[model samples]
Target chain A: MKHAAPTRTLLALYTAMVAFVLIAPTVVVIPLSFTDKASLTFPPSGWSTRWYENFFNDPAWTAAFGNSLTVALIVTVVATAAGTAAAVGVSKWSRKRMAKAAQMFLLAPIVVPSIILAIGVYAIFLRLQLLGTLPGFVLAHSVLAVPFVLVSVSAALAGFDDRLTTAAASLGADRWTTFRRVMLPLILPGVVSGALFAFVTSFDEVVLSIFIKSPYLETLPVKMYASVTRDTDPTIAAAATMIMLLTTVIIAVGLLSMRRKKIA
Target chain B: MPDKTPGAGTRIDVKNVTKRYAKSTAVDDVSLSIEPGEFITLLGPSGSGKTTTLNLIAGFTELTHGSIEIDGQRVDHVPAHKRGLGVVFQHYALFPHMTVAENIAFPLQQRKTPKAAQAALVASVLQTVGLAGYQDRFPKELSGGQQQRVAFARAMVFNPRALLMDEPLGALDKNLREKLQLEIKRIHQDVGRTFVFVTHDQEEALILSDRIAIFNNGRIEQVGTSADLYERPASLFVARFMGESTVFKAQVSSNGSDWHMDFHGSTLHGPVTSTVPGKGALVLRPEQLRVAESRADAPAGSAAVPVQVIQNIYLGSGHKYELRLPDGSTGIVRTPLTERTSLRPGDSAYVHWPAHQGVLLEDNDLVSTT
Candidate 1:
């Protein structure tokens, strides 16, 4: 039962303050979601579940939520599979400088400004006549999501002993069997976390969603933006709070699994 | 633990195997003919291609040129998995998520052995490695030495053709390393399987190998028994690598029946193995050379040179004296503690060796001082 030193206590307090500042916007929306009033105001005169009800009752809000969920699920699957494969290939095959340069090029979507990427994607989708389609949004979101998955899986691969695969092969396991038995299990945590990151990135994406949204097809973030601009709807607060909750749960799951891995 | 043979031994013939990277050669045209149940150690300094040769033999690395045959069947083109060989790496490389039994059962599972047979084999191997009750423990739960035993058990449980170990005990502490060295030797003897061990430790090579292949600059310098290498080295490199020696750079002068070299105005005679020589190094082992206070005390016909003792290091059983010869070159002489008086630093002494013990290697600088 040793007390913490003053410097350690101060450091903890400073970190808490910074974290509160960062999460203040999301925390504000959570309280507003339960306000009795129709306006988005803090410390409401009375508290009620009206905004949550408003979010559930409106067809537009429900449709937007449904669209976001479907798109994010599709993006997570597509991006995780493709990105994990790419990360493995980069780690195994790209041992030379030119191939490594090619790997960096493939990860460019994560580094480029999203507004610029939105412009480019919008132009391409316009000519392809995929502007308002689900596939178009899924494709754009997957491109943005691929880099997060790639980075995560690649870091995991770096820690993974390629010698394990060699050892497997020497033990009479074929290439496919070695990959299935040795490589996949060791890197599954990375793949899962990458999938979660991909889902969150796609769910919260606003710039690309705005660029490609049709009048009939609005994702949750796009719908929230419209509500914030067109009306001070408290239901938008409920949507934001729900979106934040989803991401927090996903990230917490990732962190907890990582901690368990360290302990194990 | 006892002499229980589990698998048939393999005769590996590496015929002129060569491996090249983009910028350099990892292994040159090296060939070795290993018997069915012989333990051969590939001994060299790091980057001398000992491990590369082992990898090539294990079918882990593809040969740039040449071929290999196992049991008289050409296997140069076979993939590592199909070769049915066992390889133990420097690091244990144990699968952390697997239990000890599962790790040992991996090869049996791969070969589609029945579940009951797999369990029996895993249990037997666990006992063989002296980890009988530790089957349920994961690799992460074990100590470094325990993990190493698990790795060794996993590799040998399959009972493949030959076991290739690449510095397997390099990461362990001294005591554990010595203990495992004996374990590995006992296991090799009990199983009667061909073992190709790669290690940079000369003492380990001497202790374990029936024959040691000395590698230098991607080529096998010499291959012989420890006594053969110690008593008669083929090259200056082998002589220096096998054990400690003081080298004398001199010109050989022969008179039909006798050979001699003039060192610091004293003409010393020795038997000549090589007649055609320009400049050669006369290599004398520390035990072969004796240090005496007076020149008259040196043996008759022995090569004698005056040396100034620089440092005297007492190594419990003996004293090692670092000396500077009159010509500015350095040398070391070891004297048994019971046989001689301890010489102090800066004392003048005569270093002499028997006439027939000096081996002349032609102009090869074996040791790089830098």
Candidate 2:
């Protein structure tokens, strides 16, 4: 094997360090989940399944996990449906002056800061008496999720001919049927990816969840934050480990299913 | 597809339809009735609105004015899918996610045909398009021609009212294009469905269409059978567009029944086909021009328009030479190229043609520089 150059060696060293800086926290949580000692730190004296035991014994951690899954699933379903419709509507705009103006408005969610959107959503939720409710939290998460759906669905629409939809309609497919059989199956990859992004966004949401969530309505991330703030607990790390594993499994399933579908 | 097109008889009346793209009129007011079971080709160059007219009929693009009726029912307000028409795009938009079988079954499935009947219909169409066993293959696995066959099978699956094809064979290679063109014609005869095909290729339109609507600037310049359009083109644009024609200016001195063309310091005689008697151009096809050793061997009253050969290209059976007249009028002439040839570059010769061979066209500024 060829030896790396001196400058390249330095670059490789820095790259490895940067990766460690980003990945170290997540990696630390994994080991801390199994730490014999009840603390969040690396290089413990001895390793045991003590924290893993804490994870299973505590009902708070399990309920948080359940809440996070419920909210994320609802958000993913709602956002994907709404975003696909909005994208399909926008895609039909004729290449004209008015169409451009309308398109920019639909894509505004992506251009504006998420924190700004979160603040606005919280304000609206407070007025509607929806704050601290799971539905409100799901809706708030969907704002962020919808943008991903838009991006993916738009990408799929770009590759499709508008005539195909019309052709479907001409073939005696009603509007809903045409969307189901022709447009949906044709753009399935984009729609599936959109749902994936929606799930991921809602599942990992922290900032917005903290603003809108009540003590009882707290998601896994919110509960973990509260537990960490109250005092040191290695159970938080175990809970984090479980959440990451769950997310990974879901993403892997969606991707593998998509691949197999394409092959078929 | 057969659903909209009755097997016995039908006529598609496109009554005064016009489509506009914002301020630009891509397709001006155009109206023509396609006879039942006839294959009509909309022939024009790019931006001539031939494809736009097809889209209007297919309901892909809504018309700004007028209406379209198939066998006498107004279809202008009908959405594309509800129009019950089959369309084949130029790029062959086969659903990439579906297998050839699934693609063919799509329209039938949309119609909710029984699954068993759908399988048989798809199978028959596959065999008809010569892809019986390739049904399981995705569009990507097939070549351009094979994918085109799949597209054809999908379009005909539901047997809609008519087949609207937008330059369907454009993406295929030369040999495949001709073969597919013949296949499409054979299918047309077998199914006896009306087809409104769009294309810019003149040869394709000539070979395929029973009648061709020659479109120009979003309007129908001429609509006739291939023979009628080729032999009796009314407009100079139609004459120049349909096929190659050599044109030279002629001054008309009278409006008599036997109007004469005073051209190139020679008087060429032809009937006065024009009622608006004035200065015109005498257009003659290259095949109409002939070369003789001398005037002694020429026919009587043959207008010997003197020309000098500037360049000669020997093309096996014949020689094509760019002939330059003294008045700077230039045209290409094709004649038999043999060892007995008497013409060469810089050689002076007289150009002669039959009187009826000359067509009088208005001296417009639209002479194509291309």
Model 1, span A30-110: residue lDDT tens: 888888888977887789998888889999999999999999999999999999998988888835786588678878998
Fnat of the models, one by one? 0.95, 0.74
Backbone clash total, candidate 1: 0
Worst 10 residues of 2 chain A by lDDT: A163-172
List iRMS for all predictions. Answer: 0.8, 2.0
The residue-level lDDT of candidate 1 at A214 comes to 98
Give residue A9's lDDT in candidate 1 (0 to 100): 96
For each predicted model, how many residue pairs clash, with residues at least 3 apart or on different chains?
A: 0, 10
TM-score of chain A of each: 0.93, 0.87
All candidates: TM-score: 0.87, 0.90
| lDDT score, candidate 2, position B195 | 89
lDDT by residue for model 1 (B24-78), tens: 9999999999988889999999999999999898888899999999999999999
